[model samples]
Target: MEVHAIVDDLAEQLSKSGERWLHASAAKPKYFEFTPVELFAVTERMSLAEPTHELSADISHLVEFLHCVKNLKIRGARGYIGSSNVVWNALPFSLHLCKNILALWFTDCDVKMVSGLVNIRKTAKRIVVHYSMKNIEDLLLESSSIDDPNLLERWQRVEEVDFSFNDIDSIHPSIVLLKTMQRLNLSHNKIVNIGDQLQHLAFLTELDLSHNAIVHIDEWHTKLGNIKTLNLAGNKIANTHGLRRLFSLQTLDLSDNAISDIESASAVGKLPVLEKYDLRGNNVLNTIEYRTRVFEGFGERFTEIELDGRKADDREKDTVAVRLALQKAKKEREDLARLRKLQIDERIRFLSGEEHVARSV
Candidate 1:
């Protein structure tokens, strides 16, 4: 079937399903369960069904009217009152309408925080905010306290979140509250640091933190070994020390960084399952034998390799293996030196009378 045709048919089905729920008894609750796409599309209509003015009387003025919405989307919204400035107080009541929300989308607006939307937290499965990047300094400016229920509520039952295209500078510690998050997008922002709180996203599989000002990274999460995709392109990154824990990553994007040499990305070779690596537009790309050395630097088998969008042949993998063997030999020397130092320390302790005795085997 054609793609648009499928979407049109799904729309018709959802319209009928929503109308049926208006008068149906509580006996049949199956109507509430909606597909991710259906829920996302249906959210635009789930608001209070009232004008923006009513929201100004009090933040909770529309609570009764909002009670019927199951998926709320308030896009391009501005306050209808004096200064017409929307604040954090304006969000909860807008989302509080439906007792059982499936998702909430606040796009192209001035929403600043996710602190007081707990009314929908119990049932909301997804929370998304993108663009409308005028005001988001609250969530990224200062880390919220761990006990704050409003901040914690936003992460409780959520599975995915996209806070992209906002000029965010830092990550709030409250991000750790997302116990069920599987995919996260913080791309196209001004972010520079991603603190230890990221380790809390233990269930994450795909992470996009591209188009930022990040210069360094440390592998902070102990449980994200299964993450399959990571996009760290378009940053000022020059170091690769913190990526060793993502052993399961299959697709990695480290293009458009400040790395001047292939050896600087030696960590990429440590990822056991890496399949796709993008390295172009960096200083090393202009060097002789740069393309061949990249395969060895990546240190893994892959179906495809794109250097400046130009594909390399399969023979490069074998060439890469030979290079990696040399790297291994260097590492073995370092390990042997450490072992010898341990032996010397033991002998010194024995001769100094700090340890007693020796047994001949």
Candidate 2:
């Protein structure tokens, strides 16, 4: 038998079963569980009976089936659609019919599949559209200007966006139109520079741009000052020159980067309220007296921040104290030696002057 015939037969059987259950349920107490396929059939029947009724459904199999047979219609789905873990060549046509969907889960689907999400732009509060492909700017943004009515209408209310694990090389300039956006995750992409693409998002707080090709941070104070938690792990960052301005930064993750020297890495210590940090994979981790040097560079905040993963223990604190004392002593000694040399030079000059004067007389 063909797939269509099999599906038709299963739908008929399930529909009959649903009808029998509905007629027999008033008198006797009975429990029934419906599989995804059965639920799809029964729900379709219910929708046909009452076209205006809203329903939540797990439509993973339905989406896969629609991929094979493009003409299939899913009639009554207005709330949550679980289409996760499926390889979608394109979003199924039935998804366009769901105008009031609460949350749409498209995890592990190809990025090309999101091209069909035009109808649910305003209804969906949370849309998880991540997993590998290219060029999201065309998929989401049609105009370059942030004030474009088309762009604002499409993404203004979206609060959180996760575009991780894609081949995105740069952030779309129009992402600033999401005026209500708070959290954005662009990790595991090919991004290199941030370059004012995100400066206007004043409400954005948590940003994850880890595991990319980023080298320089490009003075993030103006661009990311409102951000509270920042993750730049697994990149090619060598310096922290731009981080001193993050007055509200609380948690910072720079693990698995290319930060090589203590002077370059110590810039993170200037972040005012920084409480936690991870620098486990940087080359500076092997610097001579690394912890002590970093602790000293951080000035008075050595006791306020957590290094690697944990706060400094008694032994480490004592080591930092001893190192600081020794460093102060070394500086004092150098100053004293310099002063003595200057005095000796002055005395020698005076003796030479006196000898010359005596000879002249």
**Highest TM-score: which candidate?**
2
Per-residue C-alpha lDDT of model 1 across residues 73-116, encoded as one tens digit per residue: 65553444235453323432223336766676766555553333
RMSD of each: 11.0, 10.2
* Per-residue lDDT of model 2, residues 1-361, tens digit only: 1224334454444444544553464355333322233323433443443321212222333333322221112222222345554222333222443444434444344433233345456654544445534655644653234545333555535677777887888876656656567888889999988767577788889989999999988678877648898999999988888887888889889999989999888887777788888889999999987877777776667887788888777887888778778878999999999999999999999999999999999
lDDT of 2: 0.64
Give Cα distance to truth, residue 55, candidate 1, Å: 22
For all candidates, the clash counts are: 2, 0
For candidate 2, list the clashing residue pairs, or say none: none
- Compute each candidate's TM-score over C-alphas: 0.62, 0.64
Clashing pairs in 1: 66-97, 67-97
Report the backbone clash tally of model 2. 0
Off by over 4 Å in 2: 1-94, 108-119, 142-151, 154-157, 322-361
